[model samples]
Target: MASPVTRRESRHFSFISLPIEIRDLIYANVWAPKLQLHVFFKNGRLVTAACLGAQTGDESTGTRVPSGEEMTLADNRPRGWASRDLVILRLHSTWGNHYRCEEDWNPMPGHISTERNACISLLLVNKTIYAESIRFLSQHLEITITDTDTALYLNDDAKPVIHDSPPPMIPRQLLRSIRSLNVTLFGSVDLFIALALARDYNATTPLEVVNQEFQQKVRATMDSNQERAVGLLPKARQWHQIWPGIAALPHLVRVNLWMNHSSFDSWSNINERAILEPLQRATWSPEVELVVYLPNIASDNIVPGEQFNNNDEDGLNFRVVRRVRCPDRVAEDSRVLFIVHDMSAREQEEMGDQGLSWDLGEMSIEMDRI
Candidate 1:
């Protein structure tokens, strides 16, 4: 009988030797965002659109109000929070509690809102599909999640137990296993970080003073209450710290931060090196392609299969080896097609006439009966 590590190593061993293009095609399509399984909203109602920002809110009403380029809801996210922490977004109960008003619950509010049943919908598929999704998608993107909380692990009750050579976090393993990466910084915090780095995350004069005051208070909170949390610092600095590992990955030939002008650093090499230094190991040269999406300031920025067009000759930084706009596909398939089982006729009709004519050994999509 084979040992666990040996068995696990053999799991994707077949793909290990496959042609590069074959591997990438599988990675791209398999990991591509599944718009069908997920739901979207438009203009404060649950509607669909060709683009994510189809039904964005009023620009005059601004980022403070519910708009399409929305992120985590105002009610769910802790205001003046740290930039790296995503704990608030993942808590389903928290979302259920806040995000009141039926209008607030409207489906679209594009660009990925974290509010309950909003643009970002993650279904808890069985462990195998989740595992496979992570594995297939990890080859293209170094999926780093940041939260603003001082505590690295939000829940105190579930203490993080480090095992000797334990199975790595699915996201980490995917990042490590892949030869190329298409990294993304979704969520508002990442947006904020990109803006700060790009010198475009701006505010009014009085708003700047207010933000500074808020930052000072946040600093005080960390010093007073969360001083012991591991790998945590001030929100601004934490964003700066998350990039080095991606650059160092020997297999990473291409990367997309999912940001725009609000993200490209003048000293990108330095920024990339900073992330790579700690994660460096003996390896090959993977000249990464970094892609950044500019700020989409509409409320309807949450198109699940949202594609960032690469038609512009100057839209991309030409320095990297290969950079194609593969859309924001990472972390999307798992969210949309949460559970896909080859279905019977009954099951097919149940999923709003998805019309899945799947046979055994064929692929299909399913959702838990609500």
Candidate 2:
């Protein structure tokens, strides 16, 4: 009888007495979703999911893990929750956004999956846990924006309205809390262009640097192929609209831009110079790094069964070489370049962009290649 009473009393001991690092590790294990959490506004309510397909699936058929069983196995098999945590999407005043709770979410409709439940059970357990967990989870997870429209707009009168002028999908309250954000420029470039333009409008862009000599060179390049010339103008105009938005994140430290192949395949030295030159000239606060993942280049000339990353002093670099080969002499080499954070608006003025490299292809450095 005493043993049972002892166990019950131990559960009520202070959790705050543990070291902060241990407490933080516990918070991460309990709250951070294993995969990217997709946040968007649906029917005037904020909805988040770990799996992208979960966004459209019927909630009635979704899996629900009870509070105590979140880490347990089901049907003689592990539910893969060993590393993943549910992304609860309920609106709360904790962030100070003061989003109005919808009737569908207030009572947490029966059909709503446990993954969508506002797991404030931990928050309810004690105020100390709530304060420590919120700050840790907010910074640690990598949030991906799938659809910009849903992220940046609020549903009003059955129509979506930009949350604020020049529109940002993330709430101002949560902006300072996030450290990493990823946005893919897969279909449309409007949102990205807006971001880039907002970053540095006054700097001289390549599109705007057409002098008499430059025009002559452009015309000569186009003389060999008139069709290429015709397409350049519209495309340049589009990119000019994007780079600013990339540079304008108010409180971001890192951003990843995944660009489609066709969009950048035609970029010549001149075009690449234009897009990058302005960045070197512009200034950023607390410095924000941008990693541009260009589509892989198709070339059979690449060495097979080889993959490696480079220790470029300028910035972080990676090169992924594959094994198989196509019938034709064409294969894709996925490479990426990094733009390091500019320390300040003034520091960048003297040092330029710090990590501007033109080596887009595999470098011929004579060293051990992975």
Candidate 3:
């Protein structure tokens, strides 16, 4: 008779039954990845790794140069070849290589390993999850611009595949929704001038002429018998031209500018004040704050972990919050932190030893890290 007692099944609870705040925190913890968007202008295409995946180069994709036996030490490589494609930065083989200098192989540029699908996965979890996940991403996106190639846009054309979704790129509308921007601007006067000139020239020059000249140059660089690859249009845009659009973003609250080591031969040649004077004069709403990062500067010039005080009004209130010298890397590869006075001492303490942190919209600055 006891065998007749049937087993009852345990009831499953709905995740939505939890408080919205708790649900959101859970989503953030599960979806956190150092979501960085790498933007580069290659050929004529303005590519964002977050949208269209990072461009693949010869070394990265394992495309080997011709056998050493096929090439001689006297062979002349094309000029600006390495600049055009960064994959050749490493010495693949020592044989016949003229530059016998010691070579330390740097990892292939751009993000090699990333949780590229975390956000997408959360989006597909459910409708409520999708909304919350996307909102989280929109607020926390860190866009790192390393090249001023062409005008950047997030559209159907730039979208890449994600979980079979046709247009996986973050929507243009979503980009405009972002509130905080973190950028690493390589300090190079020559590069900036060239970019500015390119932009200026394009204003007067026809697009077709630019494309024609770009194609001709590309063709000239390749061997006559080699199959020509599809070339990008000539990009003539400067990063500064894009600044106005960025500043105008309705939600923008803060900007983090990291001054990377100058790509030029020596830092002594840079007129640091003159180069940065333009930005100092640039206007912004009182609500917005600017943080400047001077990486690898001498400790004697500026003390680390303390705000630099000129003790005067009307000057931009700049503070040195922290200094991080990557131990494994060269000394010049360190990061010196600076923040606007708008950020309180409490806020600086909260950000202690943490990598670039941001708070946008209703979200608190204590974001869940990957």
Instruction: Output the number of the TM-score-best candidate.
Output: 3
Top lDDT hit: 3
**Which model is ahead, 2 or 3, in terms of lDDT?**
3
RMSD to true structure for each model, in Å: 20.1, 18.2, 17.1
RMSD of 3: 17.1
The segments of candidate 3 whose C-alpha lies over 4 angstroms from its true place after superposition are: 1-17, 35-114, 125-127, 149-168, 187-189, 195-237, 261-264, 271-283, 295-370
Better of 1 and 2 by lDDT: 2
TM-score of 3: 0.46
Candidate 3 lDDT over residue span 230-321, tens digit each: 12123223343455555566766777654433231222223334334434544566677767654333333333222232342246533322
Candidate structures ordered by TM-score, highest first? 3, 2, 1
Q: Candidate 3: what lDDT?
A: 0.39
Candidate 2: stretches off by over 4 Å = 1-18, 51-127, 149-172, 188-251, 261-282, 285-287, 297-370
Q: Score every model by TM-score.
A: 0.29, 0.39, 0.46
lDDT against the true structure, each candidate: 0.31, 0.37, 0.39
